[model samples]
Target: MTTEERDQLRRALSVYVEGAPTAPEWQDWNFQRAVPDRQHRFVTGPVVALVAAASLVLVVLGGITLLLRGNIPEVVGEPVTTMTVAPSVTATTEMSLPTGPVNPAAYADVPSFQGTVRYFQHDPALGSPGWQATVSVRFAEPMRFMYTVVEERPGDDDFLFLGGAGTTFIGDGTQIWLDEADDLPPLQTQQPGFFRHLFYDSESPSPAWNEICGASPERIGVETIAGRHTSHIACSTTLEDYELWIDEESGVVLKMRGPLFVGDLHPQVDRDGGFEFTEFAIAGVSIPEVKIPQVEIAGFFPPFHMVQEIDFGGGSVDTVEYWYRDESTWRESIIASSAPSAVGSFQLVADGQVGQCILEEDLCSVVPLEGDRLLFGLQLPSPTSRVPLEFVGDHCDQLAEETILGRAAFHFACDGVRFEIRGTWVALTDPTVGRSDYWYDKGTGLAVKYTGEGWSWDTQLLELEPVFDDAIFVHQEVEEQASEPWPDTYVAADGIVPAWSGPLLDGTTLDLDDFRTLPGSEPGSGGSFVVVYDWFPTCGPICLDGITDFQKLYDKYGTTDWSVTGGPNIEFVSVVDDDVSVAQRTNERLGITVPTVACFADEIDPAKGHNGLCTPDSPWSFWSIGVPSWTVIDTDGFLVYGVTGRDYDFAELDSLLADISGLTES
Candidate 1:
């Protein structure tokens, strides 16, 4: 057959496979049957090759259809089309009483919309490299909504291709599906007013808007945006200034610009750094048909596995593998590439039970999954209809309508914890405290971007796909395994305190046993007590509070002569799990008068007595889950009382002190 004929045949075959009722008439025209005007040529050469290729494609497609049978649902209903409704701009027009408080209720209506938003950030102080992300969003009520994200950064080429296929919230926005098999809870519980503003150009005037615009917005005259005439308005908050251009007829925010602040209890905006929308477009969108795939155990028998490599900085890397078994049961295995012997594994069953096994220690423990324990799974928060306005306290103030990437967001400032962002990573100081600056999309109530002291996260939507896999919700029996009890050494209150000798910050080298003897007296004289306080310099504000409390107690009773009672004289010593310089710094910062000992040296070599006081092998080291643990050692070197964490029983401490002082209770 001629090349032209071959091309024609290919097109005909494609059409037939795509649901054509009948094959093309060319199928009956065979070259093998002698043509009336041409010499007979048996079907050979290119024709045979072309026929074979076409046959293979058909076979493959047929096999795929068979495999997906019953799994892929047929489209049952006609395509649903939703129109984008533009809000009336009269309420926002200059003639509409611009001198009064803007009524929030006037902008409460929200319309559905579908569009793309892009974000870009540049900070020369953080280096010449910058960050960028693209998000695509689709919204349809009574069904499901989707958002996909693709991110990129200079010098990080791999992230350019690493896209978040985004996530889908199914059913009345209660259930969420992520990746291919992971299930998560909804991001929001109710529809937020901001969604109406971001997606539909409709306004939902919130308290934040009233607080910011109520003061009196300066009208900057008229401006044109995307061919639409808009009224420009300038506003300000306590932390940042903003400029917004609103469509005069639709009341939709067409363009916005302002400084970016971290979303935390304390608003921290970078005077030199800000974000703006580069492009925004609204249009009607058709809801695509989506089918939740059925999950069968037989499809993933011998276990389906996935591996991920994590870089922990400082040249340390770890490999994590997820292995799925049965239907809802899976195992996570972690191996330290630098230390092969350091291996850990966890098994999660459908019944919300999780088991952790330490291979090197030959130990395993099983526990129920709840609260923060869910972090072990591949679940994440979903964007919901309600912007978490509760996080904004009375101290918060509305800033401006800011365009981040392409999405119009309502920017607000409030008291929040401060954080520092170096590139994409964020580290918050005083992690327990602080509020964040929120850039909420008015249309979706989705927080497209949030910033706080040291950190920020921007969600850029990507393509949406069905993520439901019922097997992920299946429950399985939790296999019970005998676990070894945790080791108890200095941690035991009744155990004998281990012997240790070290130099104090006051230039005194002494053994713990020395405290048992009175100066210039016999070795077996009166008993004495050693009060050891263990703490970390990097602990949160609560830890500092603990230090202050300890200092107050010491000042009131440190020198008291408890020797009159049967109890020994008290000697206070603070052991810090850091270098001497850090320890000294903490003592000075807290105004602690007590002597402090460093656990490590500047070299930080544990073998050379660095961190020796806090090392697990040290007898003086008391195991604590957190900072500010207290240990009381009697004159005989026995641990009398050991407490871990905060909220100590001060009554007990007072009672012990009274007994030692030989004083009777009132």
Candidate 2:
């Protein structure tokens, strides 16, 4: 197929499966990113393994993620499109208000939309994520756009470089760029998926934006923004809902309001006043009064910190801190613990970087990141959500108004929730949540209580502040009267995946030591090459296909009797970060041939798939930040190669096998 055709098919499949990097880019990254052995380093003397552990930079994201490469095409890809990002609460359009209901879905994402939209933010705490932008777009086939922010605040112009005011970003469905000026060669260029969260795509769209379980939006009249008619539409995929203002003539979303990629949303307006579009028309939209979409959030959204006491049954109760500052940066610290600082005591996340420290050992490690994401399949909702019910999915029923901890709250009957604390995650009120009660404060939207099954727990909001201390955000701190841990600095080094062992879904133990024996030095003859396949339960179609293809890989390249005796060539193991039960269900559903494990027994499962113990800094050491990654270990027990992401192909394994057994020239 032609490159254009492949790209087209890639876009089509991206909606179904989380995306992969362009084939050539991924192929180039396959081994180039892995650790290259210096002759002395591998000459069999004790060498210091950098505590950083040669961790590869990879990002795990929902929907789709992209990593571009090489040079740019002078001519755009097929159906290339443009886009901008930002949202406000509510605002009056300059044009006369129109009559009747309009369906934003029908006009989901149309090509060729260029307009300037006014931005309004009423955030008292965060001040405002960003100011408005005057932008123009042609399409998102590879969504692209030219953008610059409208400065209303003192530093509102800072967002032209991305500050609290908001970001100035645009993408041509294929290539995405941020904080670059026109009339200059692009200083920054990223894969289309990199800036995806900023603009809603128009082509081969995912169901999350346009269709919410086939639910219909409430058409609440139409307003003319930028002299063009727009439909104000609202809908809830669940208890939490969102509102969108779409161009009536085109499906281009004028302003997206509701939740800010919030796993949480509320019935109440996020905070009012939004973008007011002033101009409309294409031919590379000039700043003609700049007609733009202003997204008006409902309430004050800000960075925050909260302390809660969680009872983990037994005499073991733990105190956890939840801190969030934008989605890119945050920290989870355990000031006091019932048990010992259970492995990786403190974790600091900023953008793609995750820094973990074990105070007891004076050891710390930083894992490089690839994109906008969090580790271990965890979701960090804006602390200010009026009702952060995104994780509740649709399995919830509203309950009567109630008071908890002397604060007004909204109750719900739903399945249990999986909350992350320390290195492990737990399902509070799981299974029986449908019959149980979960309560959250009306204003803060923080869960105060959960009563379900045979147990009950309540969160003591010892403190909920609208602000985050900048000092705590530092990766390495001296730990003097701080929320984070001590000796945060002093990075350590270690070679070889830590003596990793975990329980398979069937409850069998998998020890890396079991596969380290090498009978002979003949190429492809002996010395075990353990191939580890990483996956998460939430991974999309593309990742699922990789797992399915793993079966074929095993059949052709992997040993047939490794389980019974030993395999000289390859031993394959698939791992999930969640509970083994979940992996069992996945195996049963997909009929995977590769043995699957859930990282640990049940105590510390991953968010949805991240192996809590296999964090890039851990012994099992695969980056917890990526899904569907491939890591190869040589008989010497060193992680020699890591392939971040690419569509599944058995041949890739063939190449890895060649590398591990020293048969590259063959």
Q: Candidates' lDDT values, in order?
A: 0.42, 0.44
Q: How many residue pairs clash in each candidate?
A: 58, 57
Error of 1 at 533 (Å): 1.5
Give stretches of model 1 more than 4 Å off: 1-494, 517-525, 564-567, 605-609, 622-626, 663-666
Across 344-383, the per-residue lDDT of candidate 2 in tens digits comes to 3566777467776644333467766543342222222222
CA error at residue 33 for candidate 2, angstroms: 44
Per-residue lDDT of candidate 1, residues 189-308 (tens digit): 122321232321333322133345544677665644444455566665532345555654434455444333211111111222222222333554454443433321112223434444
Residue 390 miss distance in model 1 (angstroms): 48
* All-Cα superposition RMSD per candidate: 27.0, 22.6
**TM value for model 2:** 0.31
lDDT, candidate 2, at 225: 47
